[model samples]
Target: MPAAATVNSPRHAMSDTLNQPTSFSAIDFLRTKSLANVVQAEIERMIIDGEFQPNERVNENALSQRLGVSRGPIREACSALAAMGLIEIIPNRGFFIRALSSDESQDLSEARAGIFGCMAMMLAERVTVAQIAILRALLARMDEIVALGEVHTYYPVNLEFHKQIASMAGNNRLGSIYQSFVRELHIQRYRALSSPDVLHISNAEHREIVDAVEARDPVRALIAGRAHILNGIVRAKKAQQAGEATAQAKAAPRRTRRTAAAMEETAAGTPADAATKPRARRGGLSKTD
Candidate 1:
């Protein structure tokens, strides 16, 4: 018989993808949970905060010693993060955080506009009074955080606002996908909105989006979300440029140390594959470049 016809349905495709197993088992899922998860979470936080600059080696030995764990779990956690696309793996080298690019940022904003707009439209049709009340309370908290200028905590609160809106949109899949981008996207937004003049404008747009959602006006909500995302893209590019400039200045001294390490390693004539390898991504978040 000819090869069986593939199920082309969206539901079937999503089910197949989500059901795929990771490299580890549940009981042993977190062998030495405290150390591995702690290291993973801390590294993730650094990526979100832009501390461990993108596209740079994540030293397994260094992190292993720092977190007081064997290289095995550290390697496992790095593998998990690579699976999440928060980091990238290069042949003959270790993992590095994914970098930002102008085109990629534009594409992401467009994707957010499309997905979030669909969500808002669905939510408007099904939203209850109680849901609106809950959202209003959350927005109030965001406003308070913004007013206090507690920059760090503002991101989590901001993510909560988006998550609530996504949940209200009545699509679990959309919400799950949106949640994945929470770390990177929020960091981008925070960087862009750091300026005093731009900060209030972003807050105003957020309020507008909430108002639209409350009014059950999908079109307005869609427009508001799109405008917000595009503005964020512009601001992020500016911020990333400034940040990269600062980082380059700091990299001058570190460059010499890195060069020496690379030369020493080369002189040893060790095979590159001895290092941790990055898993090949079949496809999902289309690899751009």
Candidate 2:
């Protein structure tokens, strides 16, 4: 019976072996050729995944140990990320994940709106039936995702939908510039979508953009696409203001208590109160005498 069991175990092991890849491909070797780029991509993924919060310091030593690489490649990766605007270097301190200020976020949104609006206009003039079909399919998928209240799941799809529009425009230089803008906008959009209400409003704007595109009206498409992105700016600003208001509300009571305690101390230590009490002069005589 034991021999039969061993024979069955060997058969199971063989079946598992058959399911596994026998060897790595050429692409695998190409990925390892640039250690800094590989490390940069991993760190960028961590930032996008919210593993590292905005302005949080990245621990070089800890990352090196975890990634099984030395500090040199890690430092190089940090510099690369900084160049890409994903992280910032603090001179003597270290690298920290970048967070855009409200004003900066607004500026980025406006810039993106102009570029994307142009792309939409261009696509409207030149888009084929197949391209329109692709955009419609993505819109349908986004609508389904939003209906199910899966806002988080819709972010990547939203990016891909815009990217497809940029690609369909068929301007390589414009596409390159648009890609950079989109990369920086990712974090800002994520913050805006923190409120579920924004999801419905945003997708509604997306539908308008698609309608304008399908109608082959360049001016209307430009307006729709640009308005959608500008509205994103407004939503991002509102979210920022809401966060600030909440933080201030939480700190208000603490500030009030501290102010009250300070006032009490000041009253107790007043010169008028001290003057009411008797005091010996320095020469062992009262001032009245």
Candidate 3:
């Protein structure tokens, strides 16, 4: 029988607060853990689902109040997110959610291409029969999701599929680092090029990658993966440019809207004399009776 697969366990850090044997210390530790979990889950969900919005400032005070946690925990959570590249920290200016940019997206895509290429090559060299079967099953499921048009369900599964393969490549450090960058990269790409059709295309490209890997062709898999990432980068860049153009185009209309609103308010606030012209009646201007 095949041996059970081993998974890495989460590492726990020693706490300085552990020295305090009082109930208050215990409660504080639990509270800190809860706060960190809540804040991390909320922020991650917002970023992945595009609810937080790009280039928006994260209001730490409001977030702390909403989460029912103190500002300290909120600050700690924001620091963690910033470390994960999910947010941009401007010194003395506070944390802002990172925006999708063409250049940045392209750079990430190129890096992903190189990393994923190396991973795929490694997997091709060392993947076991069981691993191959697992990959095939995942690819089948992915195809099923595509057939059913379940885009949302497919997205996370697809991410996990790639991440799992990267993990199986026998280098713990490489897999860990690759996994760390994957989610943020996906979120950025999706922000720039969010469309059902494009997602379907991506799935098809993934199919090609799986086929190459299953064939145990290292060069083929590497090339396919690199090409897929390169194409995605191109598409993301175009989408980012398009987004910027659309925003620029709307600027004029936005200004016009603001001007019209101001004029309406001014008209509403004006005295009657400013709004109505004085008229002469019977060759004389009328005055107070």
When sorted by lDDT, best at the front, the candidate numbers are: 2, 3, 1
Give the true-structure RMSD of model 3: 10.5
The TM-score values for the models, in the order shown, are 0.67, 0.77, 0.70
**What's every prediction's RMSD, in angstroms?**
20.7, 5.5, 10.5
Backbone collisions counted per model: 0, 0, 0
Alpha carbon lDDT of each predicted model: 0.73, 0.84, 0.75
Top candidate, metric TM-score: 2
| Model 2 TM-score, 2 decimals | 0.77
Best by lDDT: 2
**lDDT (10s digit) by residue, model 2, range 1-289:** 9887876897877876665665344456565669888888888877765678788999999999999999999999999888878889999899998988867777878888998999999988988899889988998998888888776788878888889989998999999988887767677777777677778888888888888888999999999989988888778778878988999999999999999987987877866556654453433555456
Model 1: CA > 4 A from native: 1-38, 181-187, 244-289
lDDT of 3 at 205: 82
